[model samples]
Target: MAIILIADSGSTKAEWCLVEGKKKKTFFTQGLSPYFLTGEQIQNILEEELKQKMKRVMPDEIFFYGTGCANPNNARLVKKAVQKVFTGATVAVDHDLMGAAKALCGREKGIACILGTGSNSCFYNGKKIVKNSPGLGYVLGDEGSGAYLGKKVIQHYLYSTFDADLMDRFDAKFKTSTTEILEAVYKKPLPNRYLANFTVFLAENRGHYMVENIIEDGFNDFFFNHVYKYRESWTLPVNFIGSVAYGFKDVLEEMCHSYELQLGKVMQKPMDGLVKYHTN
Candidate 1:
């Protein structure tokens, strides 16, 4: 039986699946984004984390999909790194959005979206992504994402726009000052991740009108800027894969209803769908 290995990665983590005939195994490692890690670093992760997990079995084929891999140079960096780890394996690398498209839409035409630390969307025409809205990362875009939600929450908190009860709760939960928040956002590395971390607070306090409003506004921006731009959005099923979408599914559904969007599936992780896509 031929062995196949697949990886779906984001900026924070990588999920790996190894398929040997009918048996499959899943594991995780640090993310392998070429935007953040060097070829040496990616190779080191595969050698130290993935190679050890597979033990005696080496894959015949390796498919790696990761953020920042839309660029050919980035894709080459990831492919080269994977090749170094398994010299005998055929390595294929592509963008994480493509992986999402395959996982969410399979061989069917639909709209695929990612709402994690950051956000992105594309119109997938069965075999490939025919159109994509520019995902300008967390700095300029990524509306309706965890980072975006957290950013709005922070803004409201800093501006004292939250209700008094919510304000007390926010202070009690974070015990942080405006200076600290600004420092983390401006000076720290991976500000997007740092910003996304605050979504936990929103999750904990879900259903509160204040929290709901913030999340709803973010989702609205996401649809307005990204999803709505696709002509197929009106006719096709819009599917999503990511933590934010899965976490606030009710709000997402409400927003989709508001927009009259045909909501498909919302998956926290795309690995399971990807496994089926590849195995079949």
Candidate 2:
């Protein structure tokens, strides 16, 4: 039986799906990236997490969409890792941005945007990506992402900018001390993701005005900084793929209205869309 595997690798986690005949199974593992982990480390992790999943079948084709694999060299390195496990299989490795594009836009012509731990936008013209607003990772870009919202929240919290009730609730939930927060930002690896983790606190306490403001600002940032920059005056249907965009659809929609941008649809995961694309 022919098998197909789709791997969506992000900075924080990787999702793997195995489909054979009519049966489908999914597996998740730690992220594999040359920028963050050595080749050997990635191999060990993949072997531990995926070896069991591959025991009964060999995939005939594998599609790898990974973060940090935007560079050809990085993509090649990850592809080599995948090939080790699925020897002789047809493998296609590309950037996660492409995955998001294909998952959201599919064969239709529209804009695909991802707002997650990081954020990015691209113009997909059915067949290929025509224009991309460079993400520049979390440091320089990723505006309107979880990290951006978390950063805003922390800044406001530290400077005593938010209302007293909101600050009290936030501090109580996260208990994020100044020293710990600073260390996470300055000393730890993947600081943006670290900061983004804080947004979960906001999600938990969405009723608070401060958290609402953070989300609103983040969505606005995404609109003005990234999405609008690409298609300023034109009104194109926009589809979003990511946790932030999907979870906060109402907030995003409200912000879109404020910016005069039309809201199209939101997808929680790209894999479902990918499945629909192939099946339908």
- Top TM-score prediction, candidate number: 1
How do all models score by TM-score? 0.97, 0.93
User: What is residue 227's positional error in candidate 2, in angstroms?
Assistant: 1.0
Task: Tell me the tens digit of each residue's lDDT in model 1 across 45-130.
Answer: 88898899888799998888898999999999889889988999999898999999999989999999999999999999999899
The digit string of per-residue lDDT tens for model 2 on 1-280 reads 6678888888778898887767888999988877888767777888888877678677888888888888889888888887886686898998988898888878987889998888998988888888898887777889888888888888988899988887888778888788998998999878988888878877887887768877887787778777887663266788898888888988877777777777766987788777555555
Clashing pairs in 2: none
Positional deviation of 220 in candidate 2, in angstroms?
1.2
lDDT of 2: 0.82
Off by over 4 Å in 2: none
